[model samples]
Target chain A: MSEKIDRRMLLKATAAVLGAMPLAGCDLASQDPTVRGILDSAEELTEAAQRTLLSRQSLAREFPETAISKHFRANGSDNPDDGDYQRLARSGFADWRLDVGGLVDHPLRLSLTDLRAMPSRTQITRHDCVEGWSCIGKWTGVPLGGVLQQAGLKANARYIVFYCADTFGDSLDLPNKYYESIDLVDAFHPQTILAYDMNGKPLEVPYGAPLRVRVERQLGYKMAKYVMRIEAVESFGHIGGGRGSFWADRGYEWYAGI
Target chain B: MVRATHWIGVVCVTILLLSGLQIFNAHPALYLGMDSDFAHPAASIGVAQRGERKIGVTTVFGRSFDTTGLLGVSGRNDAAERAFPAWATLPGYQDLATGRRWHFFFAWLLVLDGLAYLVFSLASGHVWRDLIPPARQLRRIGASVLDHLRLRFPRGEEARSYNVLQRLSYLAVIFVIAPLLVLTGLTMSPALDAVFPFVAPLLGGRQTARTIHFICAFLLLGFALVHVAMVLLSGVWNNMRSMITGWYRIKPEGSLHVGEN
Candidate 1:
């Protein structure tokens, strides 16, 4: 009887340890540089596998107008609390300009009217969030490639970074402003656009009014909203937190195709 | 190859499951269509307030169930509002980024290990010889199930091969469920959807695929529990020895075996 009790105790102890192992190990492993590196390598493998399998011009699935979600949830920074953004918003963003520079032959500062005047593309596409939800919306905007072509992208330019007006944190500092970067492959993709219209209306403040990016092939977080500037750079090594985007700096995958 | 891959798969699946739960907690809801209809989730775990009290509510289809302390509301003082409790998740915290890292890394390893197993199993005729039951055995599936229920496992020469039920379950897990899990997982990737346009639609859409993925994960877990229980019931030491050393002692017919009780 004593032996049986001891065996039962042993079994319970083993089960308890086994149950707790993952919780403890995962936290410790994530902090270990080697383990973290090994884990982070999967992102690169996924990106490479996707790039190899997909053609450059392959388009994300576009939905019909009827398929568009009636209420699209605005995520992350829905409205810019920055003073400059508020000033621009008060004047209907007439004074807002998208400063395009960095590794470009021509530096252009284009106004909202200027962007609207450019050749535009309208696409009804699904926006997939990294949090596992998806929403379909109609976006009307100018293809990013057209603007890059107009700016005359330098031969060395490899990445296009977007600086947004919205600050993600409590601080109203410029350093906290939301930003995202994508490689030339995504930048020149036909569906990649700086959208100014959502669902047949001018983009609302809750949905990055005036301007937001629609990188259809990637997750919603990759699509920066409340666009303030566009930069063509060879590398984002010196950019905010050096991870290519606001979320990426906070440990989200830069290549959010998955 | 089978033993090595099996052990590796065990590790991968455990990490994947815990980390997957962590990721699931980020949303804590499931939908049926292509997109999430926020107002009408097919299933959701959320915390609802009743006056000064907080309650964990789980909605399935449209029916609400109070799954407090287990599902939506858990942790000390009921502070955590998550679908699955922290104990059930890797890192034991709300870090979606780290959870994703662990999930994808192990997911890749699992896929590679499965592929290796598949190639070796086919090359060695393991699939046909062990997993696929003969027509005669298939005909006696009901009898095999009865034998299993009675805890009467095969002995002597009969013990050299899997029974019909074992063969069928193994085949289903390997061919049907695992592959479905992989395909459904890939369907969630927007980039992959662009490459394989028909995958999402074929599966009834991305959100439906997500639901199916979650269901298939639980099914795999169920299979594991049954598999482990069977291993223990049949002969724990003998099974462990065979899996570890590839030497299973087959008792002679009608011979009394040690630890038979």
Candidate 2:
């Protein structure tokens, strides 16, 4: 029977399979939670494979004397809607003392001015946002590693979590926390500055002013803006749904190492 | 109708790739916020002292980094810089201009084709019946997906039509990646922006959208790679014919390695 199959039948079979590739492609990319969850899981494997294939990447190059884009737009929330933030904004972020606590012996609450007083590092590296944009800018700030050292992280700490002032509410059950997490690896990178300044100017409120993360290895979103408090933890489990950040908690891959 | 729908989808994908690569290759200025939405992480870095000078920045930030030539072999730099994007092809003289022309000229076709495809798909039962797997399959599909990654299991359900994985991936390209690509293109274009008042803010900004567009292409490209691989595995001749002629018959009698449901 197999050998006797008609040519038309064979052609129909071929047509069916060939014709369905795009449909197959569409099927793999649906949004039903089950389909989404299934796709999301498989998608991670591909991402991991690609990551392995392209591991040990040298940081992207920085050109000499390139003009920093005239404007570096904010990627996330501009002004946080939280009550404390609204009141703080009314006073112009003056009374605001960034609390650096949790898993540290000597927790620190330094004023924005006090942070500026510390020795600062300046670099002309370009900022890459996860959204398809790049801008070369001179970021000036105290190295974040320096600030962590001042706060004195305890021996057990492994991950650091940043709690933000903004919330993008979608899941009613889930807390609306705009947060991000990074391990000790990125926490210590040289260009991983806690950017207080951009383009030789103080970071405006929109671009994560007063303090935002610059995990230069990953995309710009890893650089959280409007930083309110930073906590050092042994594990990420209790940190806002455990995936790390707001997006991470949703369906986003945790590493975001890209 | 499905035949016409299929052609439109193919055309749309082709048009999208042409225009997308053009916009990418054009080196349009990508700003900071248009292309992405991640914005959390405030863990700080600290200091380490080797000598009186204290050479390296220490551990407050909770992210990895390295120093440049100033420190040389002693330090490392993170790979996030945009000196050259992963998607930018090194086009030759002959195809470069044509690629860009085809990209810009056919940009509308991709947009229109995609819109039409979406509308048609919604009207057809195919989207609900095949693409979006039923509630029961969702749990297993999710679990099977995890199992596939660990290599403990590399299978998912094998339906005559689209499976769970195929359906979801298509959804992502259509909704997440495609719209993002379109928005980013619009952001890079001044003429378009002039026509659309809220496009920039609707997408955060032109720069953000630009970055979003590029990353989304990579996702699409990834999907295409797996699509080809699946065709070869499932039987290339059969798959190709199905796409070209819009008819597919189940192979008479070969053992199918159905993916775990």
Candidate 3:
């Protein structure tokens, strides 16, 4: 009996050490630049594979009204703490203007009322988060392509960058303003819209009240909320952290198709 | 081809499992519908304060269990409050982004390696001649199972080829469980859903697909454990040699088998 117990203990100890070795090895490997670069390449491979498999005009699945989630979960910044954002929210966004500039042939600043007058499309779609949760919500918005067309994107413009009002970071002292960017292929996709309403109601502050981009084909983080500016750029190398998006800067995949 | 793909698969599966656990730590919950109905999660792991002490609680289909030290919460002095112990996850820390990076890289490698193995197996007639049991073997499945329960593995000439139980299990792992894992994994990707709109719904829903993926991962882990035990019990050096060098030492006929009748 004692010998059996000894053997069991030895087995347990061996198993524990064997299990712990991988974790230690992986942590050390991840710190190596070459290892990280190899891992990062998978993101590009996934993007290329997905783009090849999907048509440029392929639309995400649209669901019926019954499919809408009962309580849509709001993530990231619920409300921008910036004073300008607060004041605009106080006045029901009457003074809020979406600046469209950068590589655009026609720089334009439009108010909420002007955007409301534009042709709108409403669709119910699933919002898949990077954290493995999903929510279905009905979004009503103007096609982002139409807005970009109105702004007259310059010949050099290759990417659309969305600058948001909300600031996000672990520390409030050095807040990183939320931002995201997408290539022209995704930017001009028919289903890509700047949503002003959700679930048949005027969008609430919790859900990016004034406006949020709805990139239906990508993960939730790609759909930047509290969109304050839409800039057409040749490249996003000069953007915050030089990664094109806030989350991407923090190691999340920029494409986010998966 | 088998030996090369087997080792590659071993490495890929190890990384995939550990990194997958890290990703699961981000939400630490599972659901079974079109979306995550947060109010009614099918299973979830969380930390709760009980007086001055914090306890790790794991809930499954509304039933709760205290799974501290091993799950829900674990670390040196129970400092970490994440689902799955730090030791079980890649990086040994909470970094979903890095975890995802490792997972995707290995996932692609695994798929590529699996494809190579499939092609080789088909071309070499390995699947038909080895993995598929004949009708006679199928009829004696009950007796084969009884033999396994008794730890009475085939010996001498009988051991030259895979036994019925081994063939059936290998077939199930390769043709059924492995394909399900891949299909369910692809179903969870929102981008794939856009192109193949019917995939997720056909499997019930994205959340259901996620659940199935998790279940399949555990099933694969279970198979690996049993496989290793069988390898050790039947003849560790011989089995390892066969897998490593495609040469297995078979005991001569009528030799007394150790630890068996």
Candidate 4:
């Protein structure tokens, strides 16, 4: 029994040493550019694999009105601290205009009233955040597809980028004024709306007043808040970091379906 | 085939652990309810400012515990960050994009490897013959436990077949924990949620699935630790040879070599 105990201790020591070996490589693994390249390739592979499995027209789950949360928690940039945004908010956004231009037959600068008057959709869908929280809210807005149709998208347009009023950081922080983009497929989806109202009331400032994109099938960060402009583009090459969204610029996945 | 799959499993699982921890740190809190209170969390593992110092706090079921050094608070003084340390995660920096890239890449490998192993084991009757305890072994489980606690192992012919404890642990990990991890992982994806409307609801909610995923990962980690320990204690060379090669030179009861039998 004593000899058995000795063997057990010896084995334990050996195992401990072996276990620590890989852990020692943690820093090395992170620093290795080769690993980073592999990871990037992996992300592309994942995106391709998921896209293959996902139908372009499949709608995200819509819940009953009763299931809507009491408070649909506001995500990133809940309130725009910018002076211009504050000035517009002071007048209840009466002067707010949503600019739709770039790669379009006709550029549109539509006011809040024009958007309200257009063909709209109301959907109660769950918002899944990248930070792992979820909330349900009833969004009433004009279908983005109809709005884009009015603008007459150019044949070269491949991505629709939504620029927002809310800005993060300053000149020192680079051009990180919250922006998100979706492929033409998601943009043309029936459920993709530019929400102007929530829970039977006009959108609160914290909830991105004036307008917010509701790409329900994706995670919450893809839903860029605070309406400013919508630019249809052939590619996001010239956009902020050319990765599609502000969060993407800050190292979050451009495609946040998961 | 088992050796190849096992090594791949090791690499993938390691990446998954580091990346998964990083992803968890992005939120640092989990909830059982469908809709979480963004302001406050029911359970959280992150740092909080306590006067001049940043103290780590881990809260569960509304109770808070100071896990300052390891969790909640990490790094030196002012440089301290929240939840998991950088070394323990994939990207090292707080890049969710890169972390996720590593996670999904390894996650697919893990799933494929597990599936292959499962199919192979089932078809070859390895699950029944090796991983599952026979009725006779089941009856001696109490003795097996006693022997294990006393550091006594089977010898000669008995060593060739797994004891009841080994069978059960292998069975539990291969069947229960692995599938749960995969299913719960799928439950969190919005696209998958769209395809299978029942997934999120059936699992309670997406947040709930995330919580379960976290829990399942820890369970897998625990299983891995114990599994490694077992491999060491059971005779590293012999066990490793059995896995790496098809043959294991099992020593007889009182001898160092198999031929002595």
| DockQ values per model | 0.54, 0.03, 0.49, 0.41
Where does candidate 3 clash, by residue pair? Answer: none
Per-residue lDDT tens digits for candidate 4, residues B63-83, read: 999888788777666366768
TM-score for all predictions? 0.94, 0.48, 0.94, 0.89
- Lowest summed-lDDT stretch of 10 residues in model 4 chain A? A21-30
User: Which candidate tops DockQ?
Assistant: 1
Stretches of model 1 off by over 4 angstroms after superposition: A1-21, A170-175, B257-261
CAPRI class assigned to model 2:
incorrect
The C-alpha local distance difference test score for the whole of candidate 4 amounts to 0.83
Clashes of each: 0, 82, 0, 2
lDDT of 4 by residue, A112-148 (tens): 9999999889999988888777888999999999999
Candidate 3 chain A TM is 0.90
Interface Cα RMSD in Å, per prediction:
2.4, 16.3, 2.8, 3.2
**lDDT tens digits, residue span A37-89, model 2:** 54345335434543454323233334355545555556668877778777877
> Who is ahead in TM-score, 1 or 3?
3
Q: How many angstroms is residue B207 displaced in model 4 relative to the true structure, after the best TM-score fit?
A: 1.2
| Model 1 steric clash pairs | none
C-alpha lDDT (0 to 100) for residue B145 of candidate 2: 76
- Sorted on TM-score, best first, the list reads 3, 1, 4, 2
Docking class of 4: acceptable
Residue B159, candidate 1: alpha-carbon lDDT: 77
DockQ of 4: 0.41
RMSD in Å for all candidates:
5.2, 22.6, 6.0, 5.9
